[model samples]
Target: MTVLFSNSRNAQRYRAAFFLSLPALIGLFLFHYWPIADTVRLSFTDYKVFTGEFTFTGLKNYDLALKDPLLLLSLKNTAVFFLIKVPLQMALGLMLAMLVAKPGRDSTLLRTLVLFPAVTSMVVASIVWGMMFHSDIGIVNSLLESLGLPQQGFLRDKHQALPVLAAITIWKDVGLSMIFYLAGLLAIPGEYYEAARIDGAGRWQLFRNITLPLLNRTHVFVLVTSTIAAFKIFVPVEVLTDGGPSNATRVIVHYIFHLAFRFNRFSYATALSVILAVLLIAISVFQLRITRDEDDD
Candidate 1:
């Protein structure tokens, strides 16, 4: 009779949990899963923009995308942006986290100030950064002049535009990464560091051996999310460069967006979106697999 009662109670708890999760499950299906499903279906079709008709065209869009020079360039540019943004953001974030991980008024203030840019609107950030990096009238150039240095083209220069955008985005996003790392850092047990110290472990040894390895989960999470964000870089390009003086900052999402909205190539755009989704999933899976392998090790 006691076992029967316990089983009944467990069933009731399971039922309650399912009921509580209903809203989020429904929302996930409606917002994320449904859109992705629809996009996949649309990817194989051709949309006649004026006539409002869809004709099934299997693999044609994919074939065209394979031949598209701009798409290739956008993918290359996105790879470059990811390389520039992710590593620097990760390093800077870890450093910032270490700096402000302690409990103090100064640390709290610094963390708050660091997070300010993250909460600010990206469009607004882009506009303000755009103005600051302007070739002629900007304060950056003015500062250079004051210091007897040559004024730079910055956003206008094809060579400088991509890296400049990467810098702006890193400044904006690195704060959130710091918060993640700070949480991970705080979670590390003090006793481990105490034991390491007794064993003659230096500061570098404690950080290298203890802090980093224990934060593996945090590392994977940060890396995967940062990668996705880096790949989808668009708002700054739209506001500042618009694929730039020579298509320098033409990242993947920006190109896909122009294809869909500006040029009204909905079918082709959907195909690109599907490709991007697959790419992100593949990258994420690879990252997680590596994490799993490390755990096994």
Candidate 2:
């Protein structure tokens, strides 16, 4: 009798716990899962958001998206941004991490200052950077003119727009990478550094052999995340360039925004979004596989 009563109490406790979590589970299904399912469904149809009318379009949207010259240009621009932004951000972040790795008052202060840009809102940063990059009445151009160099049209010039936007992104985001690298550096055992120092290993040799090798996982994480962030880049392009100067800075996400809201091509926008989702998933899986293989070795 006593054992049966205990079992009954335990069952009641479990039921209560599940009931307690039911609201969150329902919220997740309604907000997250349902939206994803709806997006996938809408991608296959000619959905008009304004009229709430859609026809079964099969692969028509995807076909048009593939052949769209603007999309092709956006893809190329996205690749270019990814290639340039990722390396520079990682390098700069690694450098800053190393500089602030040692714990001290000065190091703490420097780390705070370095990470300031990261905690700032991206939209605010983009707006601020937009003002800074202005040809006239902007600090950047003012400095150039002060040095006897002619003021140049930065975002207005097709050739310079993408590169300028990339630089702004790098500056705003590098601090996040720095924090990750700093954490990786801190987690390394002090004994390794002590042993290397006792053996008269130079700083560069110690870092190249010990620090860099140990940071392989951190490097992989930063690389993958930075690449994903670069692909989804929108604010800087939207606020600063609006994908202008002949679509020079029109990244994939920016192009999707232009298609969906600006032009009201809901189905086509969803198709492009599906493509982006697949691309990110593939990149993430490939990176994880590489990291796992390295670990196995």
Candidate 3:
């Protein structure tokens, strides 16, 4: 009788779990997977919004995307943005996380304040940053004037625009990354630190030997996701700068939008998007492999 009742309970639990997950599975199929499949199908054809018709083009879109000079320039810009921004953001985030994760008074308030920007909408943040970075009569220039420095165009100049956008991206995203690292730091066992202290481990030794090894997984996660986010940055460029000053700040996604909406090159834009998707997948897979190997070591 006992064994029979146990089997009945197990079956009921399984049924409940299936029912609970059914809504999410259906939503994913309807939303994400369906749209992706449609995009892939459209990419192979001559699809335009105005015409409302699509015909097979047999890799013509991909061929055109590869040949486009704007697409190539956008790809280079995105690569440079990612390479410069991700490492700097991750370093700043890790430092902030360490500072706030310590067992001390006021830590909670500090952490909450740090995370405020991350929760704000990207469009709103971009607008605010745009105002702050205005070329003439802006707050930044006003301050520079008071300090006897020349007024500089933060977002209007070709040379300064990309770096300004990169700086804004880092400021807005670093808080969330800090929160992630903070949580990872908190979850680390106190016993490790205790053991290290007993062995007369200095602060540098504690971080190098104990903290880093355990935080390896978080480091990998932050680096991969932040790199991908830097590549996909569109809102700041679109709202704050609009890839301004002769395309100096034109990232890949902005270029893709221009191709699809502005130029009516839907199929070519899809091809560029497909390339970006593949690149992100390759990076994610490489990171996973590296993390697995490190774990084994």
Q: Could you give me the TM-score of model 3 versus the true structure?
A: 0.89
Best by lDDT: 1
lDDT string, candidate 1, 224-294, tens digits: 99999999999999999999889999989999999999999999999999999899999889989988899
> Any idea how many clashes model 3 has?
0
TM-score of each candidate structure, all chains considered together = 0.91, 0.94, 0.89
The prediction achieving the highest TM-score against the true structure is 2
| Alpha-carbon local distance difference test for all models | 0.94, 0.91, 0.87
Candidate 1 worst ten-residue window by lDDT: 1-10
Instruction: Quote the lDDT for 77 in model 3.
Output: 87
What would the per-residue lDDT of candidate 3 be over residues 1-297, giving only the tens digit for each residue?
Answer: 566678879889899999999999999999999988887888899986787888899798888887888888888888888877998998889899999987666877888887888989989888887888898757888899999999998899988888888888898999988988888898899999999999999999999998888888789989889988998999999897788789998989999898889999887788788888998899889978988898998
Runs off by more than 4 Å, candidate 1: 1-27
Q: What's model 2's TM-score?
A: 0.94
TM-score of 1: 0.91
